[model samples]
Target: MTTAATDTKATGATGREPWGARAGRLLRAVLSWPNAAALAVAAFVAAPLYWMAATSLKPPEEIGTHPPTAWPENATWANYRDAFTDNHFGTYLLNSVLVSVIATLLVLSLSAFAGYALARLPLRGKAPIMVSLLMISLFPTIALAAPLFLLMRDMGWLNSYQGLILVYTALNVPFAIWILRNFFQSIPKEMEEVAWVDGASPLRTVLSVILPQATPGVFTAAIFTFTACWTEFLIALTLNTADRYRTMPVGLALFGSQFTVPYGTIFAAATVSVLPIALLVLIFRRAVVSGLTAGAVKG
Candidate 1:
C-alpha cells in the first residue's frame, strides 16, 4: 500500500485527486447545507403531490395505515373509477373548464387593449391609474365578499355561470394588465413605428405586430388567471349554493359522507382535479419561464 505522504506527492505530481480527497469531496457534496436545504424544500413541496398520487393508487384496505408504506402494495384504478362514475366529477370538470377558459379569455382580451394603451398611448394620469389598479388588486378578497355577494344578489346573478365568469375576469384583470403593460413596455418602439410607417393602423399594429411578440406575457397571464379560476373555493362556494353549478374546488370538499370519509376516492378526485392544471403548466412552461425572466435583464 502507498504511504499517505507518497500518495499526496504522487497525486500532486500527476495533477490528480488523492483517494481521500475524492472521498472528502463526495462527503462534502452529500453533506452540503445549502444543497440539503434545497432538497428539503423540494421534497416538502412535492411530497403532498406524491402522497396524493400514491394514495389514489392504493385500494381502500391498503389506505389509512398508521405506519404508511411509501409505495402501494395493491395498486388499482378502482378509486378513480368510483370518483368518476359515482361522483359528479364530469359536471364539476365541465364547470371549471368553462369558468377558467372564459375568465382567462376575457382577461387577455381586455387586458391586452388596456396594456397597449398604458404602454403605447399618451394617456393622462396613467401613473395614478396604474397605482389605483395596483391598490385595488392588493385588496383582500375576503373584505369584498359581503359587498360582492350583496351586489350579485341585488343583480339576481348568484349561483350562475355568468356571475362566476364575470367575477373571475374582473378579479384577475388588474394583475393581467400590469403584467402585459410591463411586457409591452419592454418591447422596443422602433417596431411599432415601422409598422406605422408601412401604413398599418394602430389597431392593426397592435393585433399583428406587438401582440405576437408579447405571447409570453399573455401566456403568463392566462396561466395565472386560469389557475386562480380553476382553484377558487371561497367565491365558488359562496356564490353557488346549487350542487349542479358547483366547481371542482367545491366538489372536492363534498367528497365524503358523515359516516366514513372515502380517503381513496378523495385522493382520486384530487389527482384528477390537479391533472388539467398540471398539463396546462407543462405545455406552456417555456413561455411562462420566458415571460417571468423577460424584464429581469433590463431591471
Candidate 2:
C-alpha cells in the first residue's frame, strides 16, 4: 500500500485519532491524580454551600427528616419570605451593608495613608511600628470585645451605626495596612521619584500615580475588610443590643427561639448573607490574587 493510504487507514479516514480514542484520553486525563485531587477539594469546599442552599429551599417539615434527603423533595419559598418579612431581615441587611461599606471605605483610606508612609517615608521606629501593627492585628477579637463595648458606651456610641463602623475600621485596619504596605513597597520607587520631580505633592502623587498602580492591593484590602465587617457576630451582638441596629449575622441567629429552631429560615438567611460576600469576592477575585502574589517579590 502507498504510504499515504497506510497512514490514513492506520488512523481514521480523517487521518487523525478516532473519536473513541480521543474520548478515552480525555477521560484518563480528567481522572489523573492531580485533576482528581482538585475535584475532591472543590467538592469538599462546595458541599456545605450546596447543603445550605438546598436546606434553604426545603419545606419546614422536610428540614428534620429522619435520614435526610440529599435534595429537597418539596421545595418552597416560605423560608425566604420568613427571612425577609417575619425576621425583619431587610433591616438587618441594610445595617450590614451600611456598616460594611463605611468600614471598608474608612479602612482603605486610612490603610493607604499609613501604608504609603510606612513604605516610603523616612521615619523613626518604622520596624517597631510595623511589628506592633502585626501584633495588634493578631490580637484576639474576643479580648477586645468587652473593652470596646465599654468604650463605646462611654462615648454614647453603643447601638449606633458609628459604633460598629469605628470598631470595624479599627479591628481591620492593621491587617489592611500591612497588605497595602507590602504592595506599596513592591511598587517601583522610580515612579514616585518621577512624580516628585514633576512637583506633585505627596498626597497628589499617591492619588494620581501610585494608587493607580496599587488598584489590586486596594481591592484586596477592601474585600477582606468588608467580609470581616459583614460576618462579625460577637462585636455586633455585644454592641448593637437594640433590634433596630442588629446586623445580618446577629439577625440570622435570632431566627430561632429558645423553644423551637427554624432551620429553614435560618438557612435562607444564611444563604442571603453569603451572597454579598460571595459576589464581592467573585468580582474582585483576580485583583485579590494579583495583590496577594505581587507583594511576595518586591520589584
Candidate 3:
C-alpha cells in the first residue's frame, strides 16, 4: 500500500468522512449557541415587521378582536388604498425623497473632499479633528433641535426643503467623513503620487483615481446619510411642520384622529415608508460591508 493509504489504515480513517459523522457535525454546527443566538436576534427584530405587515393586511373588524390574530384572517388591500388615497402619503414620500437625496448628495460631496484631506494631507491636529468629528456625530440630535430650529426660523428656511436638507447634511457629514477617511486611508498613497507626477491636479486625481477605488465607502456613506434623512422624525417635525414639507415619519404619525386610531391604515403607511430604506440596504449591502471593513487591517 502507498504511504497515504497505510497511514489512513493505521489511523482507522476512511478517505471520506462517514455519513453519520458528517451528519453529526452538521447538526452540531446548526445547533451551536452562536447560531441559536443569531436566530433569536433575527426573530426578535423581524417579529414587529411581520406583525406590522400582518396587521396592515387584516380587516378593520379583525384588527380589534379581543385576541389578536398572528396572521390576518381576512386579508385585504383596502388599508393600503386608504393610506394612499385618504392620507397625504404621496406628498410625504416626495418630501422625504427630495430631502434625503439632496442631503445625501451634499454630504457625499463635502465629505469626499474632507475625508481625502484628512486621510492624505500633512495637516496639523488631524487626530484631534477626527476625534472631534466622532464626538460630534455622537452628539444628541435632541440637543441641537432647539438651536437649529431657531436658526432656521431666523434664516426664514423653516418649512422649506433647504432647511431640512442643510440640517441633515451637517448632522451626517461628520460620520460620512469618518467612514470615507478610513476607507481612503486603506488606499495606496503611491497611486496619488503617480497621478501627481503625471501632471494631474489634486481635484482631477481625486475625481479620477481615488474616488473610483473608494466607491464602496462613498456608497456606504450615501446609504447611511439618506437613511438618516429619510427616517428622522424630531428634526423634520420641529423644523418643517407644514403640510407640504412634512416627511414620511411625521406624516405617518398624523394618520389617525385622537379618538379613533386607524391601525391598519397606519401600519400600511408605515410599511410603505420602510420600503425605500429596505430596498437601499438590500441593493448595496455588499458595498456597505466592504466599506465598513476596508480600514480594519493595515500592512
Candidate 4:
C-alpha cells in the first residue's frame, strides 16, 4: 500500500501526488476516528426516532413481540387514521403549528433588533450584558416553570395560544439574540455605514442591507427557535391544562391512558408530530449549515 507521504515523494517532477493516492488519503481521513465517532453519535440520536417511525407502521402484535424486529413484520395505517379521527391529534397539530409559527416570527423580529443593537450600538457594559443574557439562557427552564405559570395565571394568559406563544418567544429570545448578534457582527461594519451615507435610516439600512446579507443567520435562528417550541413539552404541558390547547408533544404523551398505552397509536402520533419539524429542517438545512459554518469561522 502506498502511504500518502511515500506517494507524495514518488510524484514525478510535476510535483503533484497521483490522483489515486490523494483520493485514498481523502477516503482514509473521512473514515478516521473523529468521523467514526460523529457517525456513532448520529446513529445514537437517530435510532429512537427511526424506531418510533418503524413501530408506527407495524401491526400491534409485531410491536409487542419479544426480541423486537428492527423493521415491521406487517405494516398498517389504522393507527394513523385513528390518531386524527379518534384522538384529536389534528387539533393538537393545529395548535402546535400556530404556536411554532407565531413564536418563530416573534423571535425573528425581536432578535433582529436586539442583535443589531448588541452588534452595532456603542454602549457601556454591552459585553457583560451579552454574557448575562447567555447565562440566563443556560439556566434550567424547569426552575421558572412554576413562576411563569403563576404569572400567566394572574394575567389570564394560560390555556391559550397567546400564552404559549409568548412563553416560547421569551424562552428562545436570548439564544436567538446571541446567534444573530454574532452573525451580524460578522458582516463588515462598512456596509451599514455606506447605507447610512446613502441617506438610509438605521431601520431602512437593516431592512435593505443588513437583513438581505443575514439570510442564512435568520434561517438558522428561525429553525432553532421553531424546533425548540415545536418539541417543547414541559412548558407546553404546564401552561395549557385544557385538552383543546395542548400541543403535539403533550398530545403524544396522552396517547394512552393510565390503564393501558397503545404503542402503535403512540408511535403513529409521534411520527406525525415529527413531520413539521423534519420538514422545516429539510427545507432550510442548507442555510443552517452555511450560517453555522460561517459563524464559527467569523466568531
Ranking by TM-score: 2, 3, 4, 1
lDDT of 4 by residue, 47-114 (tens): 99999999999988888899999998778998898899989999999999999999999999999999
lDDT for each candidate structure: 0.90, 0.93, 0.92, 0.90
The number of the candidate with the highest TM-score is: 2
Looking at model 2, which ten-residue stretch has the lowest summed lDDT?
Answer: 290-299
Per-candidate RMSD vs. true structure? Answer: 5.0, 2.5, 4.0, 5.0
**Residue range 1-299, candidate 3, lDDT tens digits:** 69888667554564766677678889898789999899899899889999998999998999989889999888999999998889978899999999999999999999999999999999999999999999999999999999999999999999999999999999999999999999999999999999999999999999999999999999999999998999999999999988988999999998888799999999999998888888988899999999988855521
Worst 10 residues of 3 by lDDT: 9-18
Index of the highest-lDDT prediction: 2
Rank list by lDDT:
2, 3, 4, 1
Clash pairs of candidate 1?
none
Candidate 4 ranges beyond 4 A from true positions: 1-40
Candidates in order, TM-scores: namely: 0.86, 0.92, 0.88, 0.86
Task: Look at candidate 2 and give me any clashing residue pairs.
Answer: none
lDDT of 2 by residue, 17-71 (tens): 8888789999999899999999999999999999999999999899889999989
Our tally of clashes for model 3 stands at: 0
Candidate 1 residues 60-169, lDDT tens each? Answer: 88897879989899899999888888988789889999989999999999999999999889999999989988997898888877887898899999989999999989
> In candidate 3, how many Å is residue 74 off?
1.0
